[model samples]
Target: MVFRPPFEEFEIQLVEVPAGETVPAPTNPGPLLLLVTRGAGSAAASGGAAASSKLLAQAELRRGSVAFVPAGTTIKYTASGAGDLQVWAAAVNAKVFAPATAEEAAAAAEPALVAA
Candidate 1:
């Protein structure tokens, strides 16, 4: 958002990937900002779509670690320890980026613009 609401784009989503569980995160709409806020975990990205995805890269994620997943990539997250793995996703032009109300535009613009 412009300091006064100009270019309102992108979304912020919080997700918790618990231990003993693996979840697929498909980021096809736009680039992703993966920030591990709490707990420890790991994420892996592949080369192809589901069922045939080849491992492209992997990362050991912990507190203060950040991952930049490109627009057309898929990443899997699994909590490593007892605590749940919490992630803050800031995706540009995806998720809750659509702002129908004037107020939403203001709130939405701040993060998107600042992130950019």
Candidate 2:
């Protein structure tokens, strides 16, 4: 997955996982923050097991859950049901790695004098 980090802003990524598919390993060791927007699923890491292999996070996420993935922790995911598993994920210090900037606008044209 690709995350876009804005200037003085957080990096964001939308993930949609099919049933029986797990999220890939972490390419980097960073703090991951996920917010469920659509479907639900289970998540885990090197420290613990997923929440539920069939349901979503009805209550608070456990330590091994996706919400508790600490820094330097290797992360992965597992789909719950046939429905999709959609989430919004972000990382800490994303802006530090790569930041965004605004583009400058062009100047207005000047009017010319004409003879009658």
Best by lDDT: 1
**lDDT of the candidates, in the order given:** 0.70, 0.55
For model 1, what is the C-alpha lDDT against the true structure?
0.70
Clashes in model 2: which pairs?
Answer: none
Estimate candidate 2's RMSD in Å: 11.7
Give the CA lDDT, 0 to 100, for residue 65 in model 2.
Answer: 35
Each candidate's root-mean-square deviation in Å? 9.3, 11.7
Error of 2 at 65 (Å): 10
Local error of candidate 1 at residue 103 (angstroms): 22
Worst 10 residues of 2 by lDDT: 54-63
